[model samples]
Target chain A: MIVAERKPLDEIEAMLASAERVLVVGCGTCVAVCMAGGEKEVELLASELRMRAQASGQRRRIDQVTLTRQCDREYLDALAAYVEEYDVLLSTACGAGVQLLAERFDGKLILPALNTRFIGTAEGPGVWSQRCLACGQCLLHLTGGVCPVTRCPKNLLNGPCGGTNHGKCEVNPENDCAWTLIYRRLEKLGRLDLLDAIQPPKDYRPMTKPARLVHPAFQTESAPPTK
Target chain B: MKDSIACLGTETEGTGSGAFEPKVVAFCCTYCAYTAADLAGAMRLEYPPNVRVVQVLCSGKVEAEWLLRAFEEGADAVYVAGCALGDCHFLEGNRQALRTVAYAKRLLAEVGLEPERLEFFHIPASAGTLFAQRAREMTDRARRLGPSPLRSKQAVESRKLVLPPDPHPPLPPAQLGRRIRESEEL
Candidate 1:
């Protein structure tokens, strides 16, 4: 899922200075799981903004709304009726959600309340660590389940470079050597011989180009239907 | 002689005063503090009646604004009771609650309220008696502190005048009509 972190309160406040009526919209999907933006968080932010406005002697009306998924047009349509009630929208969704709101709202102002972080998962409770770079390729089969592109400081495809010592990366001793992990996993699987096979330098063109995936099940027929 | 006159005035004031009955909001974790409060009631152990308990799935669910809202809604004191550190039912829920409480304290202080009015206590589900004791202790401390200054007359008088609610009916249908017309032009 896409990970995000909330922007500072002061920065968010600054964006809505002219907005007398503000709508704080939260996404209940990716940002929610990451604890950046969710229904609960949306309410909390709205209350905070209300308090701040009250303290500043500004009588602002701040309303909060949460959608099942902010990136989807169907869910965003739920906000159609209430969108005009506010001068601005503070969206606590991923980057996609923020843009979706802008596109749907058209001329209405939409501001992001979160810094979109990365495609990652929770490593432990409250600890989210990046696991994929979305390099438009799948090399997990060659490197065990770990992706050196994200885990390794240098995206080494075949490595346990001399920089790896005692299963720790010399770049930062605190970090586990991704290549060491790959080596150990392969050794345990008794596929150590696979490492001996030489791999060509990765094709950067694929990583640089915009990638798209089409599910065969969802594919549309190429030919136009008869009238 | 001047001090004695003031003391006499204070003594006369004291005679008319009643016992401090604090209004407290207890945000209790369902697994521990809420259950402990129930246990205390079952055992017929009487604590202050001032506390109003709000049961949350986890203490981590308690956001900084919830505590602030408690104060805004006239709570003189707020307490968050959760499972012991490192023993949260949801792993790090209690730890997250702890961080939130700490941040809330700083925010309360910034907003001119005594941070002590907000308290956090960690106890296991088995430690029912400990929970009761802590609640009682917190209630006593709040009673001594009296009501929060945020709700005091002095604070209210000092507050700036807020503008009245928007008298102008929302931007008329004509404005929305214009917006729609402009969109079509694009």
Candidate 2:
């Protein structure tokens, strides 16, 4: 899931400095799961903005709406009916959703209310950790199931760096050496032989910015009739 | 105050039962303060009826939002009672409650309300006397602060701060349409 955190109240207040009418839009997906941009957060932010605006003696009207998801146009249409009523649309979604909303709205002033953090998995009830870098390749077959690309601060491909102290990395003592975790798991699985093979440079083509993908099964136009 | 600001969608319900008596909402841990309150009643201890206890499985269930909502709904003061340190049934429920109150107090003060109106107590379940004493203490403190300024004519205006449903300086729907279309070219 994607992780995000709400921006400071002062910054959000600054964004609405000159605005008279503001509509805060919240996404009920990733940011919601992360406790950042959910329906509850949208209401909280809207209330705080109204309180602050009134304090300044400058009149501002605020409203809020939460969409099922903000990364697609279909969900955004729910907001389109009244989109023209407000001068500002403050979005509480991840960066992808924010960009998509801007693209769909075209003319409305769309601003982000959250700082999109990273793609990560929850380690515990309130704990999350970066698990995959989406490097467009998989090396878990050779180095155990642990990922070194995101775990290692240096993104080391081969083994632990010289800065590794015992099993901890020098980058931050709190972090463990990613290679050590991989090595131990592979050792326990009795797949140490896989480590003997050398790994070449990673392919970066699949990870290009603004990347797009279409599944082979979805290419109905060029395919022969199915069995 | 307008009827919209006069009421909050909170659990305190109704405009309270008449008179000018201060209303105190107490969030009590079921394992500790709730049991203590029961014991206080059984022991025939005396405490003001102004204090109302809302029970929870753990004091940790009392969120900061709930505390603020209590204030919005005519609570002259809010108090959270839980187990003493090192004795929470869920290990750290009381500690979590304490942290939340500390953080909430700052915000309460910042928003022109008395921070002293919010408090937390760590009373053991068997300490019925302490429960009654704390109840009287909270009631007295609230009486000293008088009613929430939100009730007075020289309004502090926290109620008016409720968001949504109320937008400032209403604009004509027709004007909003043309303005949005004109701005679209930018």
Candidate 3:
């Protein structure tokens, strides 16, 4: 899932310094699961803003709303009814969700409240570790299940580079060497021979910026005329 | 004092002549702190009435939003009173509440509010005296801090203009007890 963390309160407050009526929009999806932006987080933020405004003797109106998923047009449409009620919409969704919301609202101000971190998985309670870089390649069959693109600082394809210090990355001693983990997993699976095959340089073409993909069935104007 | 600043949705107690009386919201775990409050009452202990005890199944059930709500709703101070460490009825519920309180304090600080206004207290069910002491401690701290800056002039004016509905209407205990007994007998 896409991981995100809320921007600092001061930064968010500064974003709304000129705006009197602010609507905080939350996404009940990936960011929600990560505890960055959810219904509860939205409420907490709204409450904080309201209190802060009142405390500072500033008369500001703050409200909160959570959409099922901000990236989808259907969910974004729900805001159209009351979109005019606020001067600004502060979105607490991932970058895609925030951008889509802005696009859907067109002409309205939509500011992000969270820093989209990475495509990652939960490591433990309140801890998440990046697992995928979405490099548009799958080399997991070659190297255990870990992706060197994300876990490795240098993104080395076949690496136990000079920076591998006793199974730990020299860049950060706390991080386990990605290649070391791959080797041990392969060794345990009795597939050490797989490591002998030299892997080529990664192709970055598919990962070009602003990548868009349409399903093969939807690529053409007409769908596959009813099965 | 009441003339100068009206109540802002918070139940203010002992509105002593012109002196500030802090309103505190205490989330009390039923297994420990809530029962301790009852014991304090039975013992006729003298404790400040500033605290409004909200009984929860466990302190762990108190979410960060709830703590934030207390402040937003005009609580001058707020606290979560749970079982002593390792003495929680649900094993680690108190520990969870501790972490939650710490997180809430950070949020309070982030919002530019004094984190000292929020606290976590560990009081076993047997510690009635301790519960009262904690209550007094919070009350004194709130008194020292004075009223929350969040209690804006608007809240004061709104309170004067509109009277909110009674959240908990007085329940006649005699009739309530008879009704419960009748249902049980039936």
lDDT over C-alpha atoms for residue A139 of model 2: 76
List interface RMSDs for the candidates, in order. Answer: 10.9, 9.9, 10.2
lDDT of 3 at A33: 94
Winner by DockQ: 3
DockQ of each: 0.08, 0.07, 0.19
What ranges in model 2 sit over 4 Å off? A54-58, A224-227, B1-24, B29-60, B71-77, B83-119, B124-128, B132-186
For candidate 2, lDDT tens digit of each residue in B67-167? 76566556788899999999999999999999889866865665557989999999889999999999999999998997765432221222211223322
Residues B1-186, model 1: lDDT tens digits: 113211221222222367556767788899988888888888887777666778899999987877877765556788899998888889999989999999888767655568999999997777768877887888888888886553322111111112233233224557789999999999
**What order do candidates take by lDDT, descending?**
3, 2, 1
Tens digits of lDDT, candidate 1, A1-227: 89899888888988887777788888888898988899877866765665566556665777777777888787776677777777898899999999999999998999999999999989876788788888877788888787898999988877777899899989999889998999999899998887887777887776764566788777886755779
Q: For residues A45-70, could you state the per-residue lDDT of candidate 2 as single tens digits?
A: 76556545544555677787877788
Better of 1 and 2 by DockQ: 1
Model 2 docking category: incorrect
Ordering by TM-score: 3, 2, 1
Regions of model 3 farther than 4 Å from truth: A221-227, B1-16, B155-186
lDDT of 3 by residue, A1-227 (tens): 99999999999999888788788899889999999998888877887787787777776778778877888777776578777977899999999999998899888899999999999999989999899999998889888887888899999987688989999999999999999998899899998888887888889999999899998866777665776
The sequence of per-residue lDDT tens digits that candidate 3 reaches over residues B1-186 is 121112336344446576777888888999999999999999999899788888899999988878876787678999999999889999999999999999999999999889999999999898989999999999999989988887533531111011133233334557889999999999
lDDT (CA) for every model shown?
0.77, 0.78, 0.84
